[model samples]
Target: MNSISYFLQPDSILFNSQDIDFKMPFGATACGEEITFNILTEVSINCLDVRLILKNGKESEFKLYKKKEKKIRDRDYIVWSLHFKTPSLPKTLFYHFKFLIGNSNSIFYYGNNSLGLGGVGSIYENHPIDYQITLFYKNNPSPKWFKESIAYQIFPDRFCNANRDGKLNATKENSFIYGRWNDKPMYIKNSKGEIVRWDFFGGNLKGITQNIGYLKDLNVGTLYLNPIFEATSNHRYDTTNYHNIDPILGTLKDFKEMVRECKQRGICTILDGVFNHTGKDSIYFKDASRSTKSPFYSWYRFKEYPYDYDSWWGIKDLPCVNELEPSFFKYIVEGENSVVNHWMKTGIKGWRLDVADELPSFFIENFRYKCKKIDSDAIIIGEVWEDASNKISYGQRREYFNGKQLDSVMNYPLRTYLLNFYNGSIDSETLLKYMNSLRENYPAENYFSNYNLLSSHDVKRIKTSVKDIVKCFNIDTQLQGAAVTRVLKSLSLIQFTLPGVPVIYYGDEVGLEGGKDPDNRRTYPWGSEDSNLLKWYQKITSLRYNSKILKKGEVKFFSPHPDVFGYIRYLPNTNDFIGVISNRSPYKSKFFKLNLKELVGQFSNNITTDIYLWNESLIVPIDSSTDFPIKIPPLKTLLFSSKSV
Candidate 1:
């Protein structure tokens, strides 16, 4: 007798081979659907009839049934399919199937009797079942408020020229224009013979205030700016004075005016708060390093490393502060005028915490208490790269999702995973599996607060993933730089419509691409704009903000195939919304069928809506039952919402 073999990738796909036949389920093809397995082999002619059985994990409620039995010459082959519904599965569960076939007196044989079948070709040793759990929810949900509300992430200094007279500073380099102040710079030499510098772009509070109308025209409701506290260099991650805005960026008065104008237009302002470390040049550090006798010396730890002292990530420029110090905490969190309280009093709506993982859980918890004391509804988002629920940073556990510390977190894991899937480094099944795992660690409301982003100041732009310059798109050398507007627009659609608060990095809507570090932090291209991609973003934002199903509806994940992925969002109390399938393949109207109703009650033909047309607000009736199959276009996401669920 031939042996049966099976293999599978983790949460990917499963394959099985028995005698002359082979069977497998394509992970991408059978996304949110159920699959059945039935295997049978003949026992000697009527020696106590026995049935072939399959057992999943000890806790799994999975059941199996056999189908038509076949006989060929000396052997009988039993056939069956495995069927069960698991639209959602816990993150930590691992699944394996076992085959128990034979009666009490009947013996199971492998290659030899010396090696018992239990140890040799046993189900555990030979065949490991491939089972993946997924969470289903509506795709591209649009709850009012979010669609019409445009989001703007400002890099502070690089955003505008803060001069009151609008006159350029003669001393400023051709690449940049300095504003009112001479901010400190950390210069470095690049590949060119000349010295490269990390100098401030001189965009300040005054500049942002002047451009308030321009932002309003873009329909922006939220303004997320990088750190504004007194600090050194371009990106102000190292804080010098948390209580004051960097003079180079603007004066305290400038911030007040900007906040006042933004409020009149219903725009909410969120400031970046770097609580993790302090600049070496900061007053706190300066007093500490001066000597142990200094009053602020207790604010930092000064251990001798070689000859001098230590720093964060081994960089002398950034010194880690002692957050555990009670006085230091009082000074930073609740000084004569608390930093958080001062800003809130100035009309700031929220804060985006930098390196939140490095700060102790106690600090964040207390920080939240302080902020809320000022304004209970103030939003507090953390910069975490993983699931905020179980996010671990600085070799310590952070429990921010228990409705204590953070209102939301930057969803970096989702961003990286999506990028990998689109780049073909992974498939949709992997995405579904990881996303389900992430959900396990977070609170339900955290979904709305999840700041999902693809490209930011920390990583390379998305366009670089598809093709190098001149490879994917036709470009005129005179225009210079790579042109992949089509790919960028498509990627933007997916980013904006995904299940979270889509965050737009400054200038990304205009199709700007840059490398890492300083390069990624280039000045916003206020001139040349990618009108096509910008329009695409506007359309998606408008739809997402207006539809409830896309905003707060339940997500129903359809089985994903290598070529396509589909999902539906149902508002049990309202109207249902559908995410017309989308894929990376450049093909239009590709058919993708998955039993989206595998979980039953979540989505069905009973809940119907009109299919939404692209670039328009009108909807046409769509019959999901009987003959309706979801079809998607390459590089596109379609959202449909009806008046009823």
Candidate 2:
């Protein structure tokens, strides 16, 4: 917006990075890789010179040569092009194109789209926006085990309790246990909105051990368990001690048994590592609380002898730790007996870091180096809610995906945009551009291993967020509400099929619904789960489990209508593929004729496939040449596979 239309026409110059013809090697690329940029100007513009402005450590400009003149839509246009290689150092490249147009000598700029979704961009006479190209290390590839796995996140205090006698394990002092297994979670807050006594639902490691078969049957290959260490809070994010499993959950032996059971069933475990802070009541903090001569004195920053100290986000109960402190750093990643290595010895496969943005880069670099030294197959995923490629934390640009740090990030952007698309807040074209923008920014290694999920422990359940009875778009049908349940099913279907490691939150698949923190972390409704939703999850997950193309195949996204978004996952050099077309408009249902002639080739004109009818299944032979009409129901999704069958 903020457009100044004075210097000439706005759409006179055209450039879009999302298209390969305009920008080669789309999105992010490895260091020293060659990149090409192209721009088109209408013949009447009389463009004199073109320059590519780049901002890395400083601002630099490079000239763009005239490639040719071409006719498009009955108009002659000038083509300007540039070829350049990224610098040797790993950094984010921010650039924009400028033009000297007309005899007036006014300079106009071509920048990212007005919305910053970054497909085709707009022309600006002033304050042009810069596009991002991430440059990363070339040789770093994520562990194969991670890329192919479908992960499940569990909140221990609320998942299950397997004891026959039904008694809590080593109950903590200041906590209350729910009387019934299905009781809603209610925090015991005081006048200051602080939880005075944490509540427990008696879900333990033994419960998880008992449900290993259930998880295996659900096709889960990875388990991302929330904080299991000894802590004052039920969430265990504030660590009392890293060595002990929270007694309320189980003993150290109990955790080992769970890991052993998971590994035997071909499931991997990733523990939550919270190194940014520790519980104020922890042994280290307590020792430093009294007297300035404690060995842990240097571990924390104290305003006055430890009575006043720096805490995470100014929370008094959690005292922040100086992560790179000599003794603390040594304790965390220094030796074989270190906290990270100590847990790795217990047979867990990876770590999901908490508040990763706050932890310094040197700390994470060493964290990865040491853990990979122990088991190179193990992975590290960080909790970063934004685009991690150019994330700036505490005034420092983080190099998380430079092939030196994290294998993947928590992909909170996917959750936001996916929900937005389903609610009809954003059209399908915007959705396509937003997703392509991410693919263009992140390297292929991290992109495939991204921790994708629709809902997590921190937010509302997907069902509660999207489940609604609404009127249809047809003028004849818009009079009353139509009670049809399709949003959750469609959302999960899309999540499973997208490029990344899809993660299912604890009770999302079973249709558990809630809002915000304590509410979102509800106990899994054991016997009363929605059968329809549960079976839907199983079918899609099973489809993913059995298909190689769904896991590692190449992807191309398309949006034939503003309300419809689609993608194709196919193995290279073959016509074998899977296609998904989702109509997210709450009111309108569009009959879509998908165009994949170029991708599927002319020979495979008649394709044999089975299209999922959500609650039912049927065999539907489709035309790959876009002639076949695919009926897409409102607030519903359609997935048809040729080879995945």
Candidate 3:
């Protein structure tokens, strides 16, 4: 008797298409849609069974039909295909292949892991390793323009200054102005050890309008301002008035001109919507606090008459609003004179909801409805910190990506993964797995439109984060500088190459460094800018703007070693392809061999190829017949583009 050997390769699995044998579309499908899945084997198999595992833990057998027998690279193989209709309703489904080899007593199972690739393992090993696909409501689509734009996040008070008067705005009653533009932000306290007041840098809307050409030079398509509305604080998360621009920042006329100038230069503006809470000094809250009979009184949840009220995270100054209150809802989104409608009437293109998880689904739905009613193309982004697709908040699952609530959420999970990978805490394989999980969880449209960022006003600057990691070990100063620069460049390379709308924090391109909150909000150093870093940013942004493959092409990842991560972004319909690889190890240079036979075969012999490292061109050959080995500096990145002329 001969023994039967069984094998399965999950990476070679294909779903819904016959031409591309390795393409697998996971997560979010429509009901009644005809879906096809295919699996390839090393040899001919007679006794193989595949099943669709439902969310209810029931395994339903799928009819596997042998599609064809073919020879690839001098190896014989068999292709198995399964076609089934997607089940009704919204639920997650997992599937795997079960093999029972010709009366053998043993059963071999193949399933997907964190990387979304195949491995021979148990069916019930550690909570369903099988491939997962989520079914969502059909006809849900995100905005078209948002998915292809390069987003630039500006902290309005620190981005730029057009007046150049070397003074700050002191119009607010209790506010203090800085004497010099390069002065460090002061967090001064009174004798009682309490923060008495805040200072301003006076970067206004006119400044932004004056610098529109700079953004255009960087090819920034979308400008995401932190908050420009009337507020006591510089950051403006606590809003005093939604309808008016902050006096210190600018007036309505200035804002209008800024928006008009940005529009003329092909840049859309995204305003930060702070609807979850209001400043204690705001008119609505002040009126309610003054008298119980006030019309705004019902807009708050008060345990007592005046002082006792529900605040956001126990912050007394920021009172949480009753979003479902008819009066409040009407004021914000429902009525003809609503804040959202009023702002959309301006030239602003979209809104990024502040603390969206705190806002109820109905409020978000109404907001989206009203915005779309006014302008169907207006995009609404949410500040969701986790996986927005299936995030559970307040004991309820959020439908942020189901096409009704948020067009996209900030991609913080990707930021964490990238930072950890570059900081030497995680390997390339782990990074790939986490990235693949995010890719599988999100809907395709939302995935592309995700606000991917490396640093923001809420977090420590990217340069500071990298420098801190290096300083923790007490390394040489020169080595530390080199390592930090390389790591930052490498991370930026990945940020620009990855799928999503890459967001550049205000001063990050100029190599700004700061810790948290007040520190991260440092004034942009105009005269002391790092020329090398700025030039590097210009080159990378140029590459992103010029390459269609980096913007919209499908991504395929390959990691030849644990320390090296690489991916190829290629458009199947077009002949454009981009290869990006990174070396995350700080102590050693790595020679990475990329398997580009299939990619190179797609191009003709006369194709142009160029390799670059931080704007410096490197010498590397473009060959189709053999695998290429490229040496990368420690903690550096190398980008190869077929379209680079």
Candidate models: Cα lDDT each: 0.59, 0.84, 0.76
Worst 10 residues of 2 by lDDT: 475-484
- 600: Cα error in model 1, Å: 9.1
Best by lDDT: 2
Residue 322, candidate 2: alpha-carbon lDDT: 98
| Per-prediction TM-score | 0.72, 0.94, 0.86
Q: Could you tell which candidate, 2 or 3, scores higher by TM-score?
A: 2
For candidate 2, give the lDDT of residue 373. 88
Model 1 local distance difference test score = 0.59
Q: Tens digits of per-residue lDDT for model 1 on 485-505?
A: 545665666665556677778
TM-score of 1: 0.72
Q: Candidate order by lDDT, highest to lowest? A: 2, 3, 1
Regions more than 4 Å wrong, model 3: 1-27, 37-51, 56-82, 87-122, 125-131, 137-140, 189-194, 472-475, 598-615, 618-621
lDDT, candidate 3, 602-636, per-residue tens:
54343333432233445344553345657877777
